[model samples]
Target: MAGWAAAAALLLLPLFAVQFTDGVNWEMVDFSVFGAMLLGAGVSYELAVRMTGSSAYRAAVGVAVAAAFLLVWINLAVGIIGSEDNSANLMYGGVLAIAVIGAAIGRFQSAGMTRALSATALAQVLVGIIALAAEFGSTAPSFPEAIVLSTGFFVALWLLSAYLFLKAASG
Candidate 1:
């Protein structure tokens, strides 16, 4: 209840800003989506906490869920190192979507964990490569080093998550 209330309060912050100043301008749809994302993150972490017994697994679950929420929210807000509408950035969402769906499909078993983690890691790589390609194809005059760095950063995170899952599965 505290988590949900805190998330709700955060979501309402922009609205309060709008009432007092012009600096904050967010549409209803923006509020709805962002609110949903926050709520979803809280719910996910709560579920992970309830379902997982191992501390390592719980930590991984917490991080992975938070990462997915952040990745999606950032891409939706400002794109993953580029324009928000850039299709190449959708791969981040794809990685997360697979994580959820793959878990369900695998019945949350050890072998399934391995496959799902590997798939997510692969998706992260694909996101980086595609984002790089998208940047090159754009008519924008100069390349942004930040884009490359961000992609590399995310790829490393996914790889680490995969390794964690593999270790958990083996143990």
Candidate 2:
């Protein structure tokens, strides 16, 4: 309940921002989509917490779920490496697809969740690699060094997620 409230408040921040400043330009569709995203994240997190018994496990799951939500949200709003139009951005789907498939096949058990997270982490690393290749292949790579560093961060997060899932499963 608290989480959902916080999510609602956080979602409202942008709405408030738009009214106060021209810098925050968002359409109805943006609000609708982002609201849905935040709602889903909150619900999913609450569910995870309710389902898990261990506080450590809950914390780990919470972090992983939050990271996943942010990854998808950021990808949709702006390209992680570049624009949303970037082909490399498509790789984010791979992470979700792998996790869903793994969960479905493994019935969302600990081993299954661990494997799913590990696969997602791998996909994150691959996205980074692809982004780097795409950037270098272009006329000249721009500042902020698209893909490599950004992808690495995401990959590291996924790896930590995998570790948490693995620990939860073992303990």
TM-score each candidate: 0.78, 0.88
**Which residue pairs does candidate 2 place in steric collision?**
none
The best candidate by TM-score is 2
Cα lDDT tens digits for candidate 2, 1-171:
677788889889999999999988999999999888888877777777778786656766676677778788877876676777666677788877886687678675666777887888888777677667656324334424656666777777777877787888888
Note the Cα lDDT for every prediction shown.
0.71, 0.75
Error of 2 at 71 (Å): 1.2
Look at candidate 1 and give me any clashing residue pairs. Answer: none
- The TM-score of candidate 1 is 0.78
Expressed as tens digits, the lDDT of each residue in 1-171 for candidate 1 is 887888889888988997999877888999999988997899877886787676656666666676677788878887764577666666677888888887778676545755776677677767677767666325433246656666667666656666666666767
